[model samples]
Target: MTPSRRAVLAAGATAMAAPALAADPVSLARDERHWARVAALFDSPPPGVIQLENGQFGAMTRATRAAYEQKLARVNRETTLYTRRGALQDVQAVRAKAAAFLGVDVDEIAFTRGGTESMLVLIGGYSRLKPGNAVLYADLDYDSMQVGMESLARLRGVRVVRFALPEPATRQRLIDAYEQALKANPDVRMMLLTHLSHRTGLIPPVKEITALAKARGVDVLLDCGHALGQTEFSLRDMGVEFAGLNLHKWIGSPLGVGLVYIRRDRIRDIEISILAEPSDAIDARVHTGTVSYASVLTVADAFDAHAAIGPAAKARRLQFLRDRWAETLRDHPRIQVLTPPDPSLHAGITSFRITGQTSLGQALELKKTLFERHGIFTVERPGAAKGACIRVSPSFVNTVDHMDALVAALKEIAA
Candidate 1:
C-alpha cells in the first residue's frame, strides 16, 4: 500500500531534524521545517511562546488545519445550496473514519458538539437512576462531569456521591479506593471514571475498573476527554458501558468535535437526549440539531495525524516530555509534583502544587510574568484551594529544548 501524504511528510520531517529531541530527554525541536509547520497550526501563538497546555487544547496539525480551511471555504461558497442531505453524507464519512480510529462499529459511534454535550446527553439518556438511586464519581474527574452529575441528581432526585482517591497514588491504591466507594454505595446505578484525571494527571485502570463495575451491576460512563488521542485504548477491550471524549484536546482536530460510544447492547436502554424518531442505529446519543458540520467533519484529520505518528511513537514522545519536566522539577523545594512518577500514571499531562501560593493568585502572577518576562504561556491552577499548581502538557511537536527553556524559566522565577 502506498504511504499517505501525511505519513511521508511526518517521516521525512522526523528524519531531517532531531538534535534538540535527540540530545535531550524530551524533544519536539527536531528540524526547523517540521517545527515551523507544527507551529503554524496555532492561530495566534505568541512569538517565542512555549505552550505546555495540550491538555486544554492542542493546536491542529497542518493537515487538520488545511483540511478544515478548505472544507470551510467550500461550505461557505455553497451556503445557499448546502443541503442537509449532502452534509449528512459528509458527517457519515467522518463518522466512519472516527469509528475506524476508535476500533468500533460505525453505528456504535455518535457525534456530539464536545465533551460537555456528550456527558449531558449521556446523563439525560440514563433515566434508569431515580432519586433514591445514586451516581458515583471521583473528586478528580473533570469539573464538567461533576456539574452534569449535580444537575441530574437534582432533577432525578438521586444522590451524587463524590469520591476522592488518596494523593500520590498507585494503580492498586486507586482500585482499592474505588472498590470501597462502590461497596459503600451498593445502590449506585451509574459510575463515572476518568481515563486520565485532569487535576492530578492520574490515569485510572479503565479495564479493571469497568470490569469491577460491571460485575457489581453498575454501568460505567468514561469521561475520556483527556484520554482519547493522548493515550491509546480500544473501547472493546475496556469493557465500559459508554465512553465520550473531545477531539480538540489531544487529537489536534477543530474545537467542536466529540465522540460518544454506546455499547451495542445498552443502546436501547437509554433515551435519546433530543427528541428524534426511532432510528435503526445502535448509537443514538447524538441528539443536538444543526451541529457544526465542518467542526465534526474535521475530526478525521486528527485521527490521521495521530496515526501518522503511530500510537507507540506518540505515546513515547508524550511520556518523554512529561517525564522530562517532572523529573527536572522534582528536586525543587517549592514544587510538590502531583503527577505520579510512574509512567503508567501519566501521559502528556502533569500537575504540581507549588509551595506558599494560592492557585488563582499564582496563576495570575505566572500568566503575567511568563508572558512579560520569558515569552512563555501557561495556565495555573485557578481553583486549587489546597495550593497553587501548574499543569503542563507537551505534544510530539514540542521539543526537549522547549522543556529545558521552560524549566530554566521556572527556576528563574522560583529564585
Candidate 2:
C-alpha cells in the first residue's frame, strides 16, 4: 500500500515552499518561489489546455476533493442511517466554520445549494416589499439573480427597477449613479447591490452605496458570489442586512455549496418561503431538500485550504495574477480591457473584448478561437449593457506563464 504523489502533496509534504504568511503580503504576492509552494497544493492543468475560466465555479483542491469523495462514499454506504444520525448538527457545525471565516456570527448564516439558490431564497423570500414598492438591480448583476428580482414584480407586487452601471466606472461615479437612481425612484424600498460583477469583474462601492440607500430608507441585498474568497472584506463592514454567497467560486469548495446571510434583527424580514417547513432561525431562509451531503461535509476542508493560503495573501496573489495580464493588455491598440486599472474594482476575475467585437457572436467566436486555436480556455459573458466580452478568471493554481500565454494569444489574435 503505497501513497500516491497527490496524497503526499495533499498532506502538505512537498518540495513547494509553505506559504511565507508572515512576510509582507503585497510583496509575497510576487514571490514566485513562495507562490510556487502555495500553488503545489493543487494538481496542474491538463497537458494541452490552460484553464482561465474559474469564475463559473472553483475547482476543488486535491485535499478537499479527496475529502469530498470519501464523504460521498460514506453517505452512499450509510444511506438514510448516516444522514439521520446528527447530519443536521454536522452541517450546522460546518456552517459555523464558514461564518467565522467570513467574520460573521454562526447564527447569521445557513448553507444553500449554490449562490443562485441563496439569491433566489433571499430575493424570493424578502418580506418587506408592498404593492407599488420597488426593488432595484443593475445590468451587471448575475442573470439568475436579475430574473429573481424581476419575479418579485409579480410575486410580491413590487416594481423591479433595473439600471445599467456606468462603464469605466470609478468609485465616486458608482456611488453617484446609485444615489441618482434612488433619488429618482423615491418609492424604491429595496435594492439588489451586486458586491462584485462577474461580467466585468466590477467591484462596486458597496458600503458607500448601502449608506446612500439607507439614507433614502432603502435596504440592500448583497450578492457576494465572486467576492467571498478572493476579495478581502467583512460582511458587517459592507453594511448589508441580506446577502447571498457561494462556496464554489472563490472559496474553493466542492460544487453544490452556497450560503445565505441575514442580519439577526432582519431575519424576520425574509420570511421562510418553504411551505409547511417552518423555522425561526436563519435556516428559515433555506429549505433545500436532500442536498449533496458530501458537498456540504467537505466545506471544512475547503475552508482549511483557503485559510492556509491566508485571506490577505490569497487576495493579493489573485489580484497579482489579474494585473499581470490586464496591465499588459490594457494599452494594446486592438484589445479593450473591461476592468479598469483601479485595484478596488477587480480581483482575479476580469473580462476584455477584442476592440471591434461587442456582439455575442463575435465574443463566442473569439472564445472558440482562443480555445481551439490558442489552447487557452475562457468563457463568454454577455450581460454587460455595453456588449459581450470574454472572462478570464485565474485561480491560484494558474501560473504567471498562463497569464503570459493569454497575453501572447490575444496579441496574435488581435493582430
Candidate 3:
C-alpha cells in the first residue's frame, strides 16, 4: 500500500524537530547563552535591520516552516485524496492539541482562518442582541473588530456604545470606567474586550472586567490575538466564556491559523454562521471554505517548538526584552512611552512617539528615519489620544543585543 501523504508529512515534521530537541531547553532567567540558542531556531531578518514590529505578524520557527512546506507539498500532490480522507484525522489531532494547550475541551474549540475571521463570526453571529439592546467596545479594540460591532449594531438595530480608555491608565481607572459604563447602559447585552491592546501594548485587567460584565448580565468576547502566546495564561484564568485567538501571532505558527473558544454551555448563545450544514458542533459557528490545510497542519509543529522553549520562559523573555529598551527611553526628554510603566499592564509590546511627532504622517516619518538612518524596523500605530506612535514588539527570537541596538537608535533619534 502506498504511504499516505499525511504520514509522509508527519515523518518530515519529525525530522525537522531533531535540531530543536538537540538544543538546550530555554531558561526562565535572563541567560543570554540559553536565549541565543533559542534565537537560532528562527530565520533572521535582513542584515542591519533590527525588527521591532513582530506584533504585526510573528516570524515562524525554522522547524515549523519546514513542516508547513512539507505539508503543502503533500497536499499539492494528493489533492482531493488528501483533503477527503487523509486530512480529517490530522486536522482533528491539531484541534485536540490546541484544546490541550488552551486548557479547554475539544468540543469548545473551533479552528478559523485567523483572528479577524474568528472575531467577526462571534460578533456577527451573537444571538443575544435585539432592537434597543446595546453593545459596547473600546477605542483600543482592533479596528476590524470595532467595524464588525458597528455593522452588527446597524444591522440589528441595536445601540452601539463606544468608550475611550485613559492614556496613562491604571488598573483601578480601567475597572472603574467599565463598571460605570455597564451601570450607565443597563441595556447593554454584550461587550468586546481586548485582552491586550495592539496600539499601546496595554494589558487590560481582563478577569476583573469580565467578572464585572458578568454580574451585569453582559456577555464578553475577548480578543486574545496578541495575548495568548506572548503571555502565559489560560482561558479558565481569563474567566470569559467566549474568545478568539491567533496561533500565528505568538505561537509562531504559519500565517492564517486561529481558533475560537466557546464555553460548552454558552455555545448555544452564538448562532451558527454557516447555515448549509447545520450542526451544533462548535465548528459550525464559523464557516471557512477551503482554507490552507498546510497552515492548519503546522500548528502542532509550532506548539511542539513552543513547548520545548516553555511558555513561561517565552513570556519572561519577551517581558525582559520589552523592559530592556523601555527602561532606557523612559527618562528621555523627547520620547513619550505610551504604554504604562506598570509591569502588570504590559508585555512584549510597547509604543513610543517622539515628543513633537503626533499625526500619522509624523509617526510614519519617524519610522522611516529609524530604518534609513539607524537600520531599525518599526511600525506606526495610529489611534492613541495624543497621536499616532511607533509600536515596538520583540519576539522570543530577538536577542538582548538587538534590543540594545534599538536603545542606541532611540537615543540617537532623540538627540
Best by TM-score: 2
Count of backbone clashes for each model? 10, 0, 0
What's the distance in Å from true for residue 355, model 3? 2.3
Quote each prediction's TM-score.
0.87, 0.95, 0.92
The sequence of per-residue lDDT tens digits that candidate 1 reaches over residues 1-415 is 1237545544543442343234442344233444445444445555577877667777786666767776777688887477455887888998999888888888887888777677767776786887688999887877778888877777889988987776768889988988999999998989888888777677888888899888898899888888887777888888876877788888878988788888777787678546677764644556776777777777876676666544555566677777777889988997777777777788878877556765577667876787679876666764333555677777755777788987888788877
Better of 1 and 3 by lDDT: 3
Instruction: Give the best candidate by lDDT.
Output: 2
Error of 1 at 102 (Å): 0.7
| Position 125, candidate 2: lDDT | 84
Q: Roughly what TM-score does model 2 have, to 2 decimal places?
A: 0.95
Q: Can you write out model 2's per-residue Cα lDDT over 1-415, one digit (the tens) per residue?
A: 1247447646672232245457777998888877777766776878899999988888777877877888888899999898999777788789889888878899999889888999888888888889989989899999999999999988988888898999878889999889989988999998888888889899988889999899899989999999999889988987878999999988888988999999999998888866536767887678877889889989998887777777788888889999999999889999989888899888888899987789999999999999999899999999888899999999877889999999999999999
Off by over 4 Å in 1: 1-44, 279-284, 356-359, 382-388
Which digits, one per residue and each the tens of the lDDT, describe model 3 over residues 165-197?
A: 887789998999899989999999999999998
